[model samples]
Target: MGDCVIEPEQDYKGRVGDDPPPYIKMPQNIWPKDAPFLREGLYNYYSHVFPLAMKLVRIFALAFGLEEAALDGIFKFPITGMRALHYPPMPKEECGTIGLGAHTDFSWLTMVLQDSVPALEILNKHGQWVQAAPKPNSFVCNVGQYLERQTNGRFVATVHRVRNQTGERRYSLPFFLTPDPDANIHALDSFIAAGERPQYEPFNVGDLYIRRVLPARHRHPTSVKYRDVPESEWKYELLYG
Candidate 1:
């Protein structure tokens, strides 16, 4: 397994929107690494969902008061992934425990297809924790860190967390769409004002991804060769209100 596992370089830093280094990699969790069935099924699902994501991106661009195509280029051949999550009912002893801690998504955007179970909650702009009720045939959408930076902080990524206590299993599918491998992410000029500064720093998509995912603790033995990403910068670094 180590042969295929690439390690990050010594100069790794967790900057949003930066290109990733050659050592960075995403994990594959499909059963039987050699089997193509699960891989193809997921790919086909992404194929059907990617276009919808693009359409939403177009909508997002316009909503941010920029041209429809303003953010479209960044997604060209972007890093995208979809996964099914299952959370079992929390035992009575663990009633107050959190199933998933509070955090923000690292992708440019996230679309969540949730079942009837309602456990996810988001911190709204007014500092209120709003329970995200599952709507039939609806997907909950949220802005991510990259989009927040690109918009000069106009669209703040919603902080969220989930917990299960209803004695029923909860399922959700979230699709994360990030920038292309070589795409550079800096605040768009259109969103900045004259003689004003951009709220974010420039970065490559791949590098930022590596920084966000490389765990701060419980790391693999091979990862010791690389620089460590600061615990303060992890996407879930902030405390839940």
Candidate 2:
């Protein structure tokens, strides 16, 4: 459907964090015209998840010893993006076997809906990759890099990957929730105590998004849009890692 689909080749330039595998991404505008159910289904799911995510944001702030309303203003104008991903079977003996490479999501939170296939694996605290088995009718939510940065390692951004060894096509819908574009993302004062340094410098969410995305999408490095983001702040590793 239209231009919403980001082909694998279009995203092969930068392999900073994850070696993105082949998958189709359909945002709302380019949802299939023939499959009305798809558009409606995604819309319905988004409606339910948005409120849940907002609630989670406040809860996370409170859990980290801050006031419940501390993180509220940043999300006043949230940027919600959803992707319907289809990962075909990749038999270990025949192919590379990685459906999606390991990486921490770039958003504040990522809610994933799996179609009951055990392809998702998360790197646990013990440094082991464990299966995140699907439970019926429930979403698996993961903290993303943005939250990890804001909390200054108090809440880790888990590293996760996908491998379709089930020998069947795997379908998943992941919803990414991010703060407003103009919001500044920085480690909270509560996270940085006296004599301790902040893990990351303050930066605008919009500029960070542009720097991280343009290269990944194989856009020309010399584009005027890149001038807005300084070279010091151009790479995702500098911003989140």
Candidate 3:
């Protein structure tokens, strides 16, 4: 785990007592040179899924009542990060016990491929934890903060986590899609009514990734250094936990 963001003894930021979930994060820029089998498998998956992801992006643009290519420029080169997560059995614990802490994806979109294990759970509007059981040959897709902000909170990002209670190992692969680094993040004019104000501030995509996203997972907090970015420049309202 030398290169992993969080160590085995470490906990996810703000999650004091919970253990960091076991996972291998694969950035699109890196590949395992020695592990041909694993590398090839992931490459195959990426090749097939990337085109489909673009189609989904276009669909989302159309859904937002914008031109089909409205979002094409920003997502021309997306930050596609994948995670291979493993949750071991803990049958003695209650089903609702957290395998992964509650959190929302701050990226653009996420598609999760799960094994035949009922571990993933999502928080519903009624404030209840609903099981996201695995369906054969299907994926669970959800929007993220980026889209929510772009749409001025029209598309809500789902809050989700994992809970292992089946006395069996649970595995999942989540592919995260984020905008290109230089893209600007702001609410579209179409999303706001006349005389209404936009709810979010404009910020560069890369700046947020470096300042907010990286620091939370850094092995040494000081490893991620940033200039004096004003608090207002990056802070945004989170409607859910």
- Which one wins on TM-score? 3
Ranked by TM-score, the better of candidates 1 and 3 is: 3
Give the best candidate by lDDT.
Answer: 2
Kindly indicate the candidate among 1 and 2 with the higher lDDT: 2
Candidates in descending lDDT order: 2, 3, 1
Residue range with the least summed lDDT across 10 consecutive positions in model 1: 1-10
How would you encode candidate 3's per-residue C-alpha lDDT over 1-241 as one tens digit per residue?
Answer: 1122232211222323432222323211345688867766775776566567779999988988899998887864455667778887766656557789989997889888999989889999999989999999998998888888888988889999887777687888888888866578889888999999988888788667656654475564333332244544542111000
Q: Report the lDDT tens digits of candidate 1 across residue range 58-100.
A: 9888876789988776765466767778898767787646788
**Rank by TM-score (best first):** 3, 2, 1
Model 3 segments more than 4 A misplaced: 1-34, 91-96, 220-241
Please say which candidate is ahead in TM-score: 1 or 2.
Answer: 2
Native RMSD of candidate 3 (Å):
10.7
By lDDT, the better pick of 1 and 3 is 3
How many clashing residue pairs appear in each of the predictions shown? Answer: 12, 0, 0
Stretches of candidate 2 off by over 4 Å are: 1-28, 90-92, 219-241
* Cα misplacement distance, residue 1 of candidate 3 (Å): 14
